[model samples]
Target: MAKDFNENDRLIILNLYRTHGDHYTNFCEEFGYNPKCAREIIRHAIKSNGVELNHGEWSEEEVKKLKKVVRSLMKKLQLQSYDGIPWSRVSQKLHRSDVQCRQKFFSKSTLFKMIPKNQIDGWNEKLDIAKFIALLKKLNFPDYNMIDWDYIKEKFSSNYFNILLRKWREMRIRIPNHQHLSLYEIVDHLYKTRVLKLFGDDPEKMKEIDDFINT
Candidate 1:
């Protein structure tokens, strides 16, 4: 359990909060507490009128304003019509952290529904896993330690790449005698069962990805 805050701690909280605003990571580090604990303390302070905190849940009006700002930025940046929303701008306008903006935008209720269907499908996690498995098979189960992490990061976005590494490790442990199986067999086994149940079975995606090894 987190320790109860005392008078000195409350003073420190108000001071750091005034200095840091919503930059909770740095605030928590300096105050020797986790983000959850820091938020609780800050909220309590605000309740007691110790400090003013404007940041809160994004209202419907805020979401509408955000969409407008995003549309404007897309035009100025010359980003593709279907490109991902720029969370940095959203964070600045909303006075929230980039992670907070991203989490709010991509939460299940919003992400898949808000973005273009094709774009969402294109960034599917299974595709990355399928691609990784194909590479592993061709490399003959090469020592993961020998693999260059930088090169792997280049191949996939940071978030999906982490997922790729995790799933690949899990597959290596769960699927015994993997060396004896062809890439297609391994992919098929993973797809047919719930073990790695990829969300959608887009025929074109499967065909494009399954014709691997040579790539």
Candidate 2:
């Protein structure tokens, strides 16, 4: 007959499975347990207890710890994308899953707080009039839904597409009679009159205009 396992025994079996991986059956044999019985107990425990997960709102300390661990791992691994983060390892430290850790880190509120103000401001400033005009010309002043946001993000090296969309809407509001003007007409008008004063002798802006014109 199989032994009646308590909570402690269940935990032991689960730990053994975690530590021994696929060879856990061998470890169970060494410990005088029927391998099949041990496996059954582990399956039941995992179903009921969820790999010892602590599911609820994250504590402030946990948030701080997550930030620290992610930064260390990213630097050590020289990771470029968030997908490269070893969330399984992070979960071992934080008692969270890779999915949970990733979701928390990339959640809009958390991401907003994590990004530096200067960096956000820099992204905001990137869609200047020259670039906006250039993009409008290239895209043929397509409607917001018609724009290929992923292509725009890649081409402009911008982090967030929503920001770009917002900036475009705001820019359109600033333009006079924008609804009636074709992109070429708008550029010709801006170049002939408004562009110089709007840029105000900024050499970088002049260079951007020259580059756009040449292209």
TM-score for each candidate, following the candidate numbering:
0.39, 0.40
* Model 1 agreement with the true structure over 1-215: per-residue lDDT tens digits: 23576657666766777877777547676657676776776764453334353356788876666666666877888854323457767666665555565555545454445555654455656566766655554455345456655655666555555445446546754777887875556655665542234524566755655564355
Per-residue CA lDDT of candidate 2, range 99-124, in tens?
A: 67877876655666766667576553
The candidate maximizing TM-score is 2
What C-alpha lDDT, on a 0 to 100 scale, does residue 54 get in candidate 1?
37
Error of 1 at 50 (Å): 16
Clashing pairs in 2: none
Among all windows of ten consecutive residues in candidate 1, which has the lowest summed lDDT?
45-54
Give the whole-model CA lDDT for all candidates, comma-separated. Answer: 0.58, 0.63
In model 1, the clashing pairs are: none
